[model samples]
Target chain A: MGARRLAEMQVEVTVFATLRKYLPDLPVGGSKYIKVDPGATPADLIQILGLPADEVKIVIRNHVITELDEIVEDGDRIAFAPAIAGG
Target chain B: MTRKIVRINMSNQKATYEDVPKKWAKWGGRGMTSAIVFEEIPPTCHPLGPNNKVVIAPGWVTGTPAAPSSGRTSFGGKSPLTGTIKESNAGGLSGQKIAKLGLAAIILEGTPAKDQWYYLVITKDGVEFKDASDLMGKGMYEIDEILWKDYPKTAVIGIGQAGEMKLSNAGISVNDPENKPGRYAGRGGLGAVLGARGIKAIVIDDAGGPGVDIANKELFEKGRKNLTEAIQEHALTKKDGGLNAYGTDVLMNIVNEAGGLPTRNFSAGQFEGAAKISGEAIAEVVEKRDGKGMTGHGCHPGCIIQCSNIYPDESGEALVSCLEYETAWALGANCGIDNLDIIARMTRECNDLGLDTIEAGNSIAIAMEGGLLEFGDAEGALKLFNEIRNKTPMGRILGQGVEATAKAFGVHRVPTVKGQSMPAYEPRAIKGIGVTYATSTMGADHTSGYTIAPEIAGVSGKLDPLTDEGKADLSLAFQASTAFIDSSGYCLFIAFPILDIQTGFEGMVDTVAGVMGIDLTGDDAIALGKEVLKMERLFNERAGFTKEDDRLPEFMRYEKLPPHDVVWSMTDEELDKVFAWVHED
Candidate 1:
């Protein structure tokens, strides 16, 4: 139930920070037009978007990071921010 | 012997610059900052109003070759977070930069033009106002990076998201050793006021050709040698694994094992996952998982302790190791989270968004009590921040701080003293800190008089960390002496080997004197501390807070902590007497 066509979901994805290195032709901070895969959980989206699921630190929805299984409705703005350790 | 303060009155957009009053120079660092704040700022004035002043000053040897003394800068203001006068200090290169500018303190007064966000930039050439519009809405790290890249060799200080939100736990950040603006004046909500006033950053550099004019080059060398040696010789200082390798996260398990750790919002004294959250654990994981050179580093330049760590997961993905003991307690144990990754992510969120870890931790714990989410449910807490990141209703309230959290949660058992969240140490279990957490001008601060007294067992020799005997006297003495150490810009760990020695602190005073070509005595150091203490006490008093405000939380004295099964027993009368001055002095 967590997998679907990318174009149907009508949501965009943005992977922040280090997640850029692992994405497909990724944006510096992340991508601007990561069309979400249909029926995909945040976990599936992260995996399909090419982020290591185990290390995908923060996921923001609508300008705020959401939980892993949180629903991604149409037109949702999902931001995947990497965890960077800084003292 | 040194320079004077430049007071910037925002009301008239005027600058009142004067020589360092003979009275102020005697007491440097926190001492001088507090003294000036009390003497000038009217206590009755609103903390966020124009009448309130923000005083930024360097320590005794802020610009000297002294090791840990390099970055200690103090900021004094009527705290929007505490509604009382607050003087918070943190490590960053800004202090040295400000000092080199030939100004001891810079006072920012009134509010700025609402549309324009202005920041202070002090180069050796002169001070000027810079445009911070592009800089606004950026996180601390982003601000630090932009400022440093744009203006090389300049140290920057800034406020983050929480500060922008005007939340109580918000703090100001300064560039750390790696030049990340992650170093914060972590306590109090002064950051909010800065953000509210439309000030985005303060950049101080040595750009105008000539830098800090050396008063006595020959004297500076000797003092530098002594300071470098002193740090190298100290046991805790010599080891990189302690702070530099793991950061303050190392203290988590140790404090828990010692039965002083605050857990589950102070309902307990030990955390179940203390080991996993410890500094040592951080080092092991960072080394093995993240691989090579990911250990803790110092917060400022030339710091030997280097106890602050930058931890990433096995995947080479970042997690926080600045995970200080208090932060670990607040976010880890107080919220019942044992997962290190969640703590790391949460810590970063707090830092990036500019929230106080302790207060946020307490706020989350109270959320657990209120059934907003389950205890230790990392996602729930993460979502809370997402709300802030999203600006949700719950997010705004939760970000507001502990008092609001408690109110929202209908929690009466708040482990706080002055509307501020308490640190990691449980006052009930470690009774001496009770005095400190209660009476500190900053409110509920353990560092004010950390009661590791019994837990630490004293570094010079062995002593009981568990016993209350002589603890009161020890707390007072530590507070007094620590004030002296903090004033000099020397790291607190200097007290480890130097506390009992007559010349231990004297060496510091002598070094500052040598560097500045001023004859500084040990007596003067202690005297400066007393003056600062008196002024802080006076600030609290005039703010309508009396001795009544100087008491521990009800639960601390009434509830018994496990393992030790003890509660705070000191009476109000006894606690009050701790501040009594000796007739001889």
Candidate 2:
């Protein structure tokens, strides 16, 4: 073969608050691992999970609030939160 | 209705009503309380001494049924904890009732000559001093039950055993709509000030009282309609929105994800147990248990946000009401405990003992760091609360707050500013909040300036949470805006929508203008905020606080917190700029 597609990468994903409705199979406050392309971004993953872009206010990768377009690597831990705040 | 000031002299036990001075007519809530404290109390005098006075006031819109979630009361006094001029606001029936009674402010002055406790019954007519010896040495819940039996259909504000013990961590408790010892003016140890005055409680009966006066009915309706619509339309505050769905603790997972959650005595940015105590978890457990527990509860009547909750036990009995985000993080993540049930129990105990949950939880975490117990020890944390209840020497030390506990244990990594413990957000990760914690007049208060909105939640706009650039400006604007919100008698949560929507901000200003019949603009309202800050700064300066006291703890400067691995990088120059206008004034 002239070129072989890069191996699919696994990333741990968790959704919190109202966004939990999209990931119905995920237990409350629990996370699951999903396979994605090597150069996939958080937005790509969100699209795969069927989450609306407008509903998500924050995208966190490896415990840091990041842009939805930020690159997600293999074995990355990602979390999504809605527009929520309290003092 | 003619709004008047009622001065209660504790020395002679007399309550006298004085007409509101022309100079003080425009003030209400924190503005009214701070103005009174600055004028009456000597800065150098002992906070618990007779020279100090306590001022209780309602906001301009408090008693109006048309104003949504505006029934907030402000309590001001010289704090025994920090020796600073303190204004603590709470939500309950007290503000609405007091305002309806036609009182602008209730000033409690002097100290009792004898070592005895008394309660005051305030009606539309006058205040009556009643013997409270029978209710002495009781918890807040017990006090609420006893007081309601004798004074039904009224609002009660009182202190519990913690205040009776004259502990610096004690907070004044106010009854919610259900008469629970939940709502509180829970910071700065104002409860100790009240305890020192020998007053156990004040029962307010608004029945037969004249209601709040609105100078311009058409203007009031216009402003009220605008604000109500904004609050209803905003995604974070509207029905079935973020706050209404999950309460404030909804920020738990998000803060943790932002690497701003202070975990295990500020040593870490994220807690492995964050999920267990997150608001999402609370909502799920409540739904699963299907018990008496429920979310979307209001702390006071006419609150459309309804972000409070009632947590229940395994038996389906209610455990605690309104388990807040700050309380959850302080007692759960900061202390390294993950169990929601244990955190709820500790919250219940704090309410009963009239303790500030933030201070109490920080103290416990400091104790853990000192090796008194292991992190994540739920039983040990509960036992420490028992010590406070028993008034043991150890208990007394812990009840004195985070700084005191740190000193007692020789722990150098204390997370406090101005002798007050920090709330949930980690300063290292969120630089703007760090500036707020360092420079806030009432000590390290998050509500003083909540920059977490732009920094983490993407409300209004997004900013780099880890950077020091332009943070001082961000914090100053928030602090100034927050001062206006606090004085208006609106809950600080209103800041969420007002920041995102311009009309929401205009609507808020218009309401006050409508109430006072004054032409006030948004800029003028912010100027009012700066004016309040100036008074507070002058008071603190007289009380011996310098730019030196406006600083984060030494350890925060050196230690690199995990995840982001950042320290308190903002310099003294940056910190000084926050209140630079105060100094100029």
Candidate 3:
């Protein structure tokens, strides 16, 4: 019975502007959202999706989400923002 | 030419509206004003006193109904940062609307009572000074919204808190269509001059505007077609999703990859976390998590190339995108903070306070080295920016300029040239930009002579990235060409296409000549550019700056930038000889 009978949880992933190149399959607007397992954090999910964490400059969560150690929960939306470089 | 130049003597507060010289019709916009500043205003004048005059002018195409032609405001002021000539342009609607009022330039002279606030209103009704005590000390955003709300259709240019104290990095702001006074003349402390004048805001109500009179309708039509088509033909325009889509933040990764991206006061050429702070990363986060538009859409009316974004907080809240590469590098890599959201917030603070992001970034980096803040501390940067508005002692030290900040903190490794903060491009890695940084009359600046013209766009055969053998000549070519482009009011990025081919040049010539009733040739363009550069140089010379002042900081020659152990190798004699064309008999 060790948590085997419960349903798997899901975490939210959000990308904007040019970062869409990482996931082109995602539609133009949000809610083209992908589902990830509940235990996996945003960093782990980015790794699972092959996005290099080093390139992600801004991370938006509900609270003081620290580094890779921070965990994700159900219905939590994590934002990924890259540095903007033009004039 | 049916244009007028408004010259105001700040010493006496007398404004003169005079007709522009026919010779100037050949170089409209930034070109026209920079030329006027060089010819009329002696460069030896004190930058802040009545002796100095700031000329704000628009480009030839500025008032035209051309899309994305809304940018093109030029300000020529004896620079508080460089102690010589400083002219910086910006993207905003005030230039377009004001120029459309048939003005070649508007010169603001002399300061007003320190405590009183006055407003300048220009329209068919004529120019007048109005009281603005209610608007004093308000943020640019707040002031702009109120003005626009009262007038509804007029253009407003206002200053923020930092400008009131006459900080060296203060920038003037213009109201945008979205009511965001985010558009700015954001360089060389021009906003401080306005603040010093007790001029809180300028409300332009040119509703019944007398637009620039095109002499020949047929020629103007033909020229407009060429200019538009040339821009439209660019692959980036069609493929990269209008800069209007994401703003200029798209350059973060690209510049980082080129090895010219500046990090941590230019100690390194690249940031390990650059990708995280890139346009791509910001776009992704804004879309998926916050369900908001990362692309800000526009700064002025009819700007098709919306290269501006509203950088959001980590929770996908609004900050400010001004998310430019230089800003990102200065605040992020230069200060060792990799967080894009925090950088956006810092940009928001600068906009609200009316400060130049580049100098602010440099100041913060210097402060961090001085132990005022720890590396990667977002709260520390915010604290400094907040104090900037308050004009605290430490805040004044930081707002004064990068050189002053470094001196106050006793930091030897400060990145500055001619008392001005160095731009995003590392002087060591980009030797061509290094030459321009050293020799530009305006002090260390990337736009002075962009080597990226050669580095990014292969005008000449692409040499090794760090080689300096032919960089001097290349730099001269860029500086000259850039001067011409700056005057045209066309975006400098258009240089990639113009330098890459002949049609682009043809389009530019047609636009300038047709607009001003002249037949300008390619050779004429060369002469004009040379003349403009000569004027800038002459101003610097009159200010007592010689070839010795035209060299980069001492550290550039010794410090080896990582990834490539490159240093600024050009000697003073070589740099002097680089602009040999200027010495032609």
Candidate 4:
């Protein structure tokens, strides 16, 4: 048998507030699609994108706030933000 | 040295200067204004009648350069909109100039005897009342242009057509750093109060005036350095961070994604076109078209954290200075209009016409709901602004504010508290802010207690926006702290770093202590804040506000906002806990 190949899943990620600095090429509110191996989580994406965990105060998956370690599925939309406040 | 109090009696057309009372020694800004209104004005008096007085005062640190954002001037009176004691702060050259003139407060009292309009030209020598018949019906921009021609160095505070009509949604306009009539003490219908006084404008020229006196210059310098460094180092307030780079509209995407953006007049918590009006998009436009348009602009002369901006049209002509988060949300998402250009125009018109942007936007939304205009119709909204300028009957009804507009149009789902239109945040999505709206003395004012910092943005600490647990306590602390900050004349945005950086908070207290020549700790600052709130609550109590008045509108409690589908879940019992300190005694 040939070496087994793992399935890759693609997820759309958006960053906001100060975290947008990490993806300078992307405009504000613009999302980027990233492909990862099966069973990829928010934490894995954070590592892949090289964002500081402390700076990432919020993470939303499919419009629901999720944890950094929550498993992500294909076509999941994720967003990150730093500590920001305005009325 | 005793600070002077300048009191103008429009009924007699006389101005008097008196030494600051010993009782007002510790009071400044909101504290001073609230104390004066509470002590002098009768609670049962009509807000626009002769009995009500408008008090304008700067904080103790104002004009001293002790802090970068210490130029806020507080305008307080019995609000015609809410019938409650109100204090609204604005950033411009007025506060610093007033402080430099050695004036603690400029109180406008009693109504004019005749229909003639007058303008007060205040200088170090004295104040002169000039006939302002030429400026009677002009917009703020034209008024500023006329005043600046004669008193170019003076900071001008004036009203416009809305104020001339004595509309409840009218606001007092202050000239920005560019001498543009853009900044505003923009809440509680204080402009109507001024308008009722028949005073068109107040020109303050502080040249060769007595500047602010500092008690401990060394300590003040040290504290100021510490705060300046902290602000410069903070991720949010720093040069390239959210505010300086893109202005406050940077909050649009985050607030929208978090499901707390009030859209379509509070019917939904999210707007699909939020991204189009985001601060990022604004920065792109400014960058793509370079001229007079730029970010990192300061509203006042000494503000270090320049969160204001100048937006230009497609042809690179300036449209407005400082299209902030609240205006963007209220005029953009809340109206279901995603176009920034239209929102910018609306903002400019409101400033020029001397109307509060939040109130105008809320009233327009109600009109849309009532079928006067369709939702997302930018052209319709622009036409309504013209109606207001022309003082048509429909415009007059809408100018009365959101509640009046809703009643006139027979719409039930009005988003207001105590007759004042709610700001940008959706109450259902952010429960802590909802509590603030329900309990704030000024009615639906977000700046009174910015719990959005901790609840939605995690500035101080992370609190789940969906939960009600600990929200009452959280809101109380924020309110108390904000009251103190407002008294200090610092921009409320400084709270972002002050909450997280211990040194920053200590530095702020030290600056005040140094200025006053008194020993003050962080705890003492909080106590002063509580005292201000207590005085305001007492005024509201005398005005007949009970626990029943401290509540979100009925619809907010039942109608579930979309995305989260959460209603305003905080109980009235929880809201009563906000002022538990007053009851504890």
Candidate 5:
């Protein structure tokens, strides 16, 4: 049953700023839908997305900033950005 | 050599240079400007009247290679918009040129006896008031071109039609490194004050001028080197940092993702079109149209953190010098307009008209809220810009600022504190910055204390933006530290690396100490900031501002913002605690 659930899971991931370089095919301010294993954490998504941990400053899941250990459900919307601050 | 203070009396039509006062010898930039205005200008004086003087001063590290972003000039006076003491700082060649001329401050005092306009030409030799009657009613871009043609080496600080009309939202434009009238000491209606003085422009030429005098050359160099290394090493300010790579518009996506980007005149916490007008998109466009347009440009020379960019038209000609985060958010998302081209054009119009883009955008938003125009109407926005250019009665009303516009149309959802419009951040989503907007001496200025750094960007430490706990202390600390940084003439952007890195902060303090020939610790820096704030608060108190003035709009208290569903949870009791240290002293 777990394997069947893993095969059915997918998530939407978006990258911004310098982190966009990690997903070369994605345009700036663009996002992509990626298939992931069931109950995949944000850390697993980062690995799947091929983003280095040091380059990723903050991550948001479903509009709230989330830790890497937090579980990502199917169809969860995720966004990540590099270190940036401005008025 | 002692720096001289240049005072130009518009009433007498005379300019004089005097020795710097011993008490103000250590003060520079915002410190000097605020100190002078607080001492001379009457708190209750009409902001655009003869009694209110406009004071301009360069920061202590200005004209030196202390830091890459150390070219900020401060403009301080009584604000017609907020009815409070204000110091609006900008990054441009004006600060560097002024400092190189060995002047501590240039005070514009007394209104002109006549209505004729004149320009002040300042060089190493002296300052002279020249006939500028013919240059009246011209846009800042036209004035910039005319001035540069005549005084190619000088930096032109001038106003536009908005200022000539004495509009409260009027700003003073300064030529950037490229000699384009782009950078503005924009806020507080200071340009209206300058216009009241009948000054068209002040041309500053540093040729053959004595540069800044460094007291401890060896110590200064050490501090400079340390800061340079820290800046280069930091991920956010380095050459490949987010800022240098995409400019300040990089914050658009981050803020939007965090659900803090104010959209549609502060009605929404997020905008669907935010990514379309982001810094990354801006860079992509510039790259696609790579003629005169370029990213990673510095506003002034000697800046290593080149966070400014040039936006070009389809034909590859320069359309705008910089499309910053605040401008993009204010004109783009706040107005419900998503097109970058329209936003860039609006920004150019604001710069040319000598209007503060933030205030102008907020005023336009207020107009939309009042049913004068529909939200997201690009053509209507342009038409309003033309109205301001023509100085129509309605245009004049709108040009007065967000508060005046709200009053004119009876808009209840006006997002302002102390009569000044809030910037891009939605206060409900970001409570710490909300606290700052309410309590800042400068009245809803983000640069006065950018609590967004820690709350959203996680520069120093991460704080949940939705939480109300410990926000007062965070706001106070940022406000105090920012005051110190503003006085130093370094761009507030340096606070990012400084907050995260201890040696960077120490290097900045040491650099100022070396320049002033005094010992300074971090605590002393905070104390200096407190002193500046005390002076400003005293002036505001005398001007009739009370604790009641320190508050977000009434709607923000009741209306819940979307996405976060948070109202401004900070209470009046919490608000009063922001400057508690000042009262304690």
Candidate 6:
């Protein structure tokens, strides 16, 4: 089946650190389900959420650090974080 | 301005000053301290004996208004904990003050034959050695209060009961801007070295003293502007950025999500209650409390990127000056406790006792693993600190750090390298940091070289956190660059911007050259770092360390951490490849 023709899927999204400002309704470190098209990537969700491309620097999928182009699967836990560094 | 190195002998209570030699002219901070320590102290000398000396030096740009966040000092000596030449630095008001006073370094040598306590009042006139009988046995909090009342606006570097007992985990405390004894040169038992010297405190007043001399004013300003622009423009370091908004604990959730947050004494990779103790949670609590709590707090003056914070309690009162990521991980998830307030209290206790929070938390976790106390027992964890404060036998064992506590309890899963406990990052999950932890001269310290930038934060370029390929080279590059940064007197957080921005790195080197009126390049700065590391490695080699000491703990080799289910898989050859130049003739 083509990705474009597939049904919508839900991915759990959590924005952390300064990225939380983009998702004001969601609590910090708290996750919310977002429905997207079948071939949705972290970049797609980010666009859907209206987060600035420059502000969201890191994207984690299923507990692994990954690029924004990686497609999200249903029930996959996705996290967006700003450029955060410390020990 | 002429810089003088102050030498104080405790045996006769005498002070002497010497001009900066040409050989040590370019050295400052870790470079200065390590060079002096390797030259003066015997490699195999007993760390607590009269032969051992403590060298404290500020970094190259410290005390200058042009250098942002350049108020850090380095303390070097033979570590009683690691039995290696150790250099531990801290951010406080002292480093800048020391620089403004026209002093390059302070060397403390010899111990009094009699058990006498003394404190030094240092100023423009000279040093005044006075009796400190009343301040003996007091906590660092009390000592800071008492000393500040006597000598207002002066920076205090002192120890607490843990240091008095010469415990292995003791750390020298440096007061923050608020006079809170929270900043620390908190590793490798340097506080015990000072305490063994019979010194209670060294109060410094830099007012009316000659400030730092910049050789080329125009060049210094140009370099400083470039570096400051990078710091202010970077996403992680800029105003209201991640660090300024959430402080260092901002890494908690991300690390937890990546399955790199060590939990239950490194038994697990992720914590169930990570959110409760995360930086976001702390910010939330700070907001809810609406009292003395705040974010964007700077550890030292002129720090534009303030990653420090004040955590508060239910009453909206200040609980701790800064609840850092390492402290939160060490005292919270590492011990199976998730309460921020409890962690803050433990943090406060560690600060008061002049103890390294990482070592203390690891000790408590090891004790818990040994059946002394159950994991997640917050109250029991709180009481264990009292054991150190009261100097009980159990307390003595705990005060010696995680490795000692592990041996005392017969716990086999010891998480230490070179007799020092590991920091927040789990090497099993993040292979690159593991390389740095194992090969670091000062044991399993995260700050020795922070690869977390590329590995976890995607600062310069994202690397697979799980891969070990080329990590040896990666760690070595970071270690060398970090050594230069440490010597430059800027906070390590500056690396976040400088690594991603080329001009910032050049600006850092230019600042050093601009200050000394000498021609220097990036290669020279890194070579300086390498030289400092080689000096430290040679000292360790003379002190009986070998390639065998560069391996991770035995348990990490086989036992896999959960979530990612990874073990320390890097080969011994790969580890040997790092710092291979140190072995070259």
The per-candidate count of clashes, in order, stands at: 18, 0, 43, 0, 0, 0
Residue B433, candidate 4: alpha-carbon lDDT: 89
Docking class of 6: high
Top of the candidates by DockQ: 6
Over 4 Å off in model 3, which ranges? A1-87, B9-14, B22-25, B67-70, B239-246, B289-292, B314-317, B457-461, B580-585
Model number with the top lDDT: 6
Displacement of residue B266 (Cα, Å) in model 6 is 0.4
Query: Per-prediction RMSD in angstroms?
Result: 15.2, 1.3, 9.2, 1.7, 1.2, 1.4
For candidate 1, give the lDDT of residue B200. Answer: 71
**Per-model TM against the reference:** 0.82, 0.98, 0.85, 0.97, 0.98, 0.98
- Can you tell me which runs of candidate 5 are displaced by over 4 Å? A1-8
Deviation from native of the Cα of residue B1 in model 1, angstroms: 8.2
Query: How high a TM-score does candidate 6 get?
Result: 0.98
Query: Which tens-of-lDDT digit does each residue in A1-87 have in candidate 6?
Result: 576546778889899998888789887557999788877899999999889988998898998999889878889999999999887
Q: State the displacement of the C-alpha of residue B417, model 1, in Å, after optimal TM-score superposition.
A: 1.4
Candidate 4 lDDT over residue span B198-307, tens digit each: 99999999998898888998888878987887788787888877788878888898888888889988999889999999888888889888877888899998888889
Q: Write the per-residue lDDT of candidate 3 for residues B1-585, one digit (tens) a residue.
A: 378877765445556788887666566655776777777667776666656667788877777766235366777777777777777887666777787778878877777655666788887656777788888778887887788777777778878888778788888887766667677777788887666666778787767778867666677677667656665565333225425455565656555555677787777777888767766666666776674446645666765555666666666666664577677777887888887777877888888888888899989988888888887787778778768777789888888878889999898887777778888777777677788888776788788778755554233335444677887887887787778777877666666545545776677777777776777887777677777888778777787877888788788789987756677787788888755555573
Instruction: Write down the worst ten-residue block by lDDT for model 2 chain B.
Output: B576-585
User: What is candidate 1's DockQ?
Assistant: 0.01
User: Which tens-of-lDDT digit does each residue in B83-148 have in candidate 5?
Assistant: 899999988889999999999899999877677788999999988889898799999989989998
Candidate 5, TM-score of its B chain = 0.99
Q: Any runs in candidate 4 off by more than 4 Å, and if so which?
A: A1-7, A24-28, A50-55
- Stretches off by above 4 angstroms in model 2 are A1-4
> Which residue segments of model 6 deviate by more than 4 Å?
A1-6
lDDT of 6 at B57: 96
Higher-scoring candidate on TM-score, 1 or 3: 3
Task: For model 2, state the Cα shift of residue B213 in Å.
Answer: 0.4
Q: TM-score of chain B only, all predictions?
A: 0.93, 0.99, 0.95, 0.99, 0.99, 0.99
